[model samples]
Target: MTSRFTELSVDCHDPERLAAFWCEVFDFKVIDRSEDSVEIGSWVPTVEEVRARQMPTTLVFVQVPEGKAVKNRLHLDVSPIDASTEDEVIRLLGLGATRTDVGQGPDRSWVVMADPEGNEFCVVRSLASQD
Candidate 1:
């Protein structure tokens, strides 16, 4: 049997702040928190929803003393569900994300950005625009 993907853990200087930033990005809610870690997750899917594969992996942020010094080796690629790509970028920017360049030149389809603590992620075309 194959194992299922359930959660993604992130190391950050401030788990609360980082978790808050990601919550807005993913439209998730903080489900759990502790002294050194925070967990944010989307709505829990029902059995039918699970059968349809509607759930997404939850994100966990843990506090680390060291700051981010190098580019992220693993990053998230997210797509807008409610707005156009450009509009989503604007919204994200308004929510404390900053546009960042990571050698993904202008011709690429994705817009690279970083969260409050400089974790890199990408904004691609909305899923609705895929057709």
Candidate 2:
């Protein structure tokens, strides 16, 4: 059987804080939450309706006791939906994200950044800018 990509589960020390941070970063809302986990997603008409339509994936943050000790082997790369990457990067920086260096050379096409919890993700050039 074939499988479709769905949720991305992240292990963090603070689920609530990380979930909130990701929600702000993606313009998503917390759809489900528990004592040790939070799931955030873009709003759709209804859960069943959205599921039937195969909505986009959501991010689930789970609380863990330990902090990040190394670089993420699988990290996210985000591009602007309506604005330039520069503007988005500036806004993200204002939201507590910090620029990070992960051995990517200066000539890289994307800018690597770390979240409040030191999870590394990239901000790539916007589609409009590439066009």
Candidate 3:
């Protein structure tokens, strides 16, 4: 049987703040919080809401003493639901993301950026605008 994807965990120096950054990025809300970790996901109005019906995986930020030493081998690529790629990139930059160069060169279709904690992710054209 194939395994289903559920959560993506990120190690950071500050779980709460990092989680908050990601929450704003994805319009997600905190699902769980602990001393060393915080989990964020798409908004769920009630406890009885069926998590099995959720569209995407949850993000978890775990506190660690060490900082990120190298580039992420696996990174997220996000498409704006309502904004253009350039607008979304600008918005993210305002929220503490900084542009990064991962050797994608000058002709890439996506913009690469790093979070407050230095994890790289991409902003791409939305599916509706891709046609």
Candidate 4:
């Protein structure tokens, strides 16, 4: 059998806050919650057990210790699901992400930004727009 990806789990300091931030960024909903953990999924679970078993296919956030240090390699790139790159960039910036200057010139393609937790990601021009 072929392997199928289930979710991209992130170890964060605050699950609820990060989930909320991501919810605004991706228009995702909080499908389930607990005292120490919260799971954000694209689709809502119909039942408790379903929620427990539900794993988001695209991305998921899990709470971790406060003192954990992120190495110099953590990052995630996101593409607009339904909106144009420009629109998505505007939406993400409004959600709390701040632009970072990583030595890439202003005219260099792609918009680079950092999430609330300081993880960097890029939004590239849409494929549809390149055609």
Give TM-scores for every candidate, taking all chains together and pairing residue i with residue i. 0.87, 0.88, 0.87, 0.70
Worst 10 residues of 3 by lDDT: 44-53
Model 1 misplaced regions, further than 4 Å: 44-55, 129-131
RMSD of 4: 4.7
In candidate 3, what are the lDDT values of residues 26-103, reduced to their tens digit?
A: 989999999999999985334234344445678989998999998899999999988788889999999999999988
On TM-score, the stronger of 1 and 4 is: 1
Please name the candidate that would achieve the greatest TM-score relative to the true structure: 2
Per-residue lDDT of 33-129 in model 1, one digit per residue for the tens? 8999999998653556655663788899999889999999999998998788889999999999999999989898889999999999999978764
Q: For candidate 3, what is the TM-score?
A: 0.87
Give the per-residue lDDT digits (tens) of candidate 2, residues 60-114: 9999889899999999999888778888899999888999999998998789999
lDDT of 2 at 87: 88
Q: By TM-score, rank the candidates, best first.
A: 2, 3, 1, 4
Comparing candidate 2 with candidate 3, which one achieves the higher lDDT?
Answer: 2
Candidate 1 lowest-lDDT run of ten:
45-54
Local distance difference test scores for all models: 0.88, 0.88, 0.87, 0.73
